[model samples]
Target: MNTTPLRLLIHGASGRMGQALQRLGSEADSGCDVVAAVSRKVDARVLEGIPQFAASELHGVPEFDVAIDFSLPQAFDAILGLCVARRVALVSGTTGLSDAQKAALDAASVLIPLSWASNFSLGVAVLHTLVERAAQALPGWDCDIVEAHHTRKLDAPSGTALTLGEAAQAGGAAPHYASLRAGDIVGEHLVQFTGMGERIELVHRASNRDIFARGALHAARRLHGRAPGRYRVADLL
Candidate 1:
């Protein structure tokens, strides 16, 4: 295994995902080090001895080897420009990107390795795989995806649900989707498969956001030496 530690920059150091990443960074493989954190407002201490930069401060900083973005949609373009300028690999978990923003990412991927996923939990990845297989095996199966997130979430039909739906389609099934944003539910995805005489359901749940943080870190490590391209969690797995 490679011994050199990967230096990292986190783009959303003030948000929930950011805090989780910060905590996970502290306990990550010895081969990983979160070198800097960039955000609009951050506790100087969260840097854990590394520098903390304002969002505008990114341009002045030196390049990092990799970065994870869980920032808002508005942060995407600037972050993409910075990452591309630095030729750094990126693992982005940001959602609600416009089509243009997504196009920009696709263009940027031609220059540097980038992995983007709506949901990073390993369980979600496995669930997607299972959904894909089930869809293929039961082309006639009727499928529906139901997901619930925190009430504060803005987007309906959470990105994870859409990803799961796409996976189901890729596996040869059509999927209807639903979303419920209530209470403090971290995340729960249920894919129901209905056939001639029976119904099969696959469920994956997350009680906290740390699972995503951990998965993002894992993806960052795997993406370091990859060729420039767009990738997903399944690719990393």
Candidate 2:
């Protein structure tokens, strides 16, 4: 096994997930080194030995093995382009992407190792697996997925819920979705399979945002020096 720490570039250093990555990556046993941090604005040139850069200075950062992105959709293109140009791996959890950006991601995957996901929580990845298995086991059952997030979340049905539906579809089940946005609920997903008299419910609830950052960091460590292709958090797990 490779003992060397993977070099990391943090792309959205000011956001919640980005800050969590920064804090967690600073730990001695993280198995990674954050070489550069990028945000829209930089008040400091360096923080705790990691060089910080404004988004405009992205081209000036030193080389890195993988980049972990949790920025907005508007900023997604630039980091992706940089990673492809540098021939390095990328792991992004940025959401609200348009069809064009997703197609661009598909195009770039052929040239570099990259993975983009809506949520980067390992529990959600395991939930996705369980959803597929349930769908496969209960043929002809009615499947419904209900997802609830904090009121701040804009997208209905949450991206993780949609992905779980896709997993159910792969197992020959059609799924219905319902979304709820309420106060301060981190995230909750319920996949229910109903039959004539009995039903099965699979649930996953996330109370902390740090899980996403931790999962993304874990993905970066696994992603470095791999074959070029798009991947899911489940694949890395």
Candidate 3:
């Protein structure tokens, strides 16, 4: 690692993950100093000490070595354009991206290293790995995924659950996704593998959103010295 602390710019500074990142950045040993925070309409108190900006104000701003974004899907393209143009590394945790958005990221990677994942929780990545292994191990076993998120979340199946399902389907038959939304449930995923005599269940639960923020921090550290490319939480872990 470099001797000096990395300067970081945070996007989506008003969202849940962004708030957790703010707390994480304030703590000791975070390895990055938050120099700037961007949000569409952030509460002034939320960014009380940090320099803040509107999304449109990014142009010609002093560049940071890394930019971590938990912004929504709608803002992804703009963020990517800004990061790549600035030659800054990126860690985006936004979900619900369309196929075209992914292709855009792929194009952006040619200019700077960029890591993107639906969920940044390390546990979720482990769950995905386990699901992939189980799906491969039990060929004939039936597969189903049940996922729960906060009621306010608009996307179905949650990105983590879909990631798990995709991993579960890797090198095997297709798996199905079942989504559930209720009051402020942080997250939950259960992947069941069924056979004639027995069933195996893989479960991952999140008590709070901080896990993802921490994971994103870890990813930022891991991705710091790499070349231009995309990465996932598993790669960082």
Candidate 4:
């Protein structure tokens, strides 16, 4: 195993996942360094010692090996452009991106090593695989997906839910989706396959945001030396 620590950059550093990454990535055993943090406004009190810069200040910031973005979609283009320009690997978990933004990400992936996932939780990735297999086994079953997140979560049918639905579709099932936004729920997803008299439900619940933060860091480590392309959590799994 390589003992050298990876130099890391955290985008949207004031956000929940960004703060989680900062806390975890600061551990001595984490095998990475948080070199800089980017946000719309640099909050010195929240992000002390570590260099904090506004998004507009990114061009003046020095390069880091990899960048983990948990920012909003509106900040994505700037982050993507900066990463590509600096040839930095990117690990992003931002959701609810516009189609044009996604296309741009695809285009940028050709130039920098980029790994983006809706949910970075390892269990969620496993849930996706299981959902796929279950969908394949239960032919002609009605598939419905339900996902719940905190009320502040901007996207309906959380990106992970959409990814789960896609997995079901890939396994020859057409799935309908429903989304719920309630108070402070970390995250929860259920994929149900209903047949004649029985039903199968595969569920994943996240009680904390740290799972995603850890997973994104793991992805950044894996992406460090990777070639330019779009990568997924499944690849890490």
Candidate 5:
């Protein structure tokens, strides 16, 4: 394992998640050095000790091992292009991407390593594995995913829930979804597999969004020096 800290470029640096990642990346034990930050707009050329660049100025940023993106869909393509152009890895958690944008990721993965996920909590990654296994074992089971999040979250059957549904579908189980938005819940997902006289429920809950940033940082460290390919959050573990 490389003991040297991995060099990271934070995309969407002005957002809450971006701020959290910068904070953690600044820690002595984070195993990461945030060499640069990129956002859709730039105010200060530098902030909190890291160099900053606007989306339009992406090509001007210093080289980095991996780019961790937590921005909106509008800012996704530029950073992805920057990483591919630089031949580096990329980790993104931006949701609500268009089909063409996702297809672009598939095409780009052939040249550089990349992992895009709806949720980056390590626990959620593990739940993906467990849900797939349960779906496989319970051959004829009915799969249902129930997810709840803060009322401010607009999308029903969030990106995470849909991703989990995809996992279940991959295991030969048809999946359904139920979404609830209430209070200030951080995030919750329950994948249930029901068979004759029994049921299995795989669950993961997030109390804070920091887990996503931490997981992306972990992924950045793991993706360094790997062959070009598309990877999942579970793959790093």
Candidate 6:
């Protein structure tokens, strides 16, 4: 294993996933350093000694190996521009981007290594793979995806849920989605295939937010020093 630590920048350093990354990435075994962080409003207390800057202030920040973003979609363009300018790799988990915004990512991917995914949990990735196989084997079944998250989660049918639905579609099944927002549910996704008196369900539940934080860190390690290209969490798996 390469022991050289990766220099890291976080785009949404004040948010849930961002804080999680800061906590977990600080460990000596994580093989990375939280050199800097970016957010709309800089919060020194939350960020501790790590430097925090606003999106517009990124021009003055030092270069880092890779950036992990969990901020709003609106911040993506700015982050992409910064990453491209610095020749930095990027990993983004921001969801609900418009087609044009996604196009911007595609354009940037050509200049630097980038990985984008809706969910970073390894279990969720496995669940997606399993859903594809089950849907392929049960052609006659009706499929449905139900996902639940904390009430503060902005996007409905969490991006992971949609990805699961896409996997089902790829396997020749049309799936409907249901989204639920309740108190403090870390995350839960269930894909059900129902047929005549028989049903199969593939489920993944996240009890803590650290799973995503760890996954993003893993992707950042894979993205470091890689050639320019668009990548996905599935690729890491």
Question: Which numbered prediction scores highest in lDDT against the true structure?
Answer: 2
lDDT of 3 by residue, 52-165 (tens): 877777664466888899988988787889888878899998889999998999999888998999888877877777888888889988998888888888888788778877
RMSD list, candidates in order: 2.0, 1.9, 1.7, 1.4, 2.1, 1.5
Query: CA lDDT of each candidate?
Result: 0.87, 0.91, 0.83, 0.90, 0.89, 0.89
**Candidate 1 residue-wise lDDT, 62-169, digit = tens:** 568998999999888888998898898999999988999989999999999999889998888889889999999988889999999999888878888998899999
lDDT of 2 by residue, 22-84 (tens): 989989999989999999999999888888999999999998999999888899999999999
Q: How do all the candidates rank in terms of lDDT, highest first?
A: 2, 4, 5, 6, 1, 3
Model 2 C-alpha RMSD to native: 1.9
Better candidate number, 2 or 6, judged by lDDT: 2
Q: Which pairs clash in model 3?
A: none
Which structure is stronger by lDDT: 4 or 6? 4
Task: State every prediction's TM-score relative to the real structure.
Answer: 0.91, 0.91, 0.94, 0.96, 0.89, 0.95
How many clashing residue pairs appear in each of the predictions shown? 0, 0, 0, 0, 0, 0
Model 4: runs farther than 4 Å from truth?
none
Give the TM-score (vs. native) of candidate 1.
0.91
Give the Å error, residue 100, model 1. 1.6
Give the candidate number with the greatest TM-score.
4
The global Cα lDDT (0 to 1) of model 6 is 0.89
Residue 180 deviation, candidate 2, in Å?
2.2
Cα shift from native, residue 233, model 6 (Å): 1.5
Give per-residue CA lDDT, model 4, range 1-237, as digits (tens).
Answer: 779889998998988998899889888999998988888986572355578888889888766999999999999888899899999899999999999999998999999999989999999999988999998999999999999999989998899999999999999999999999999999999999999999998999999999999999999998899889998898975
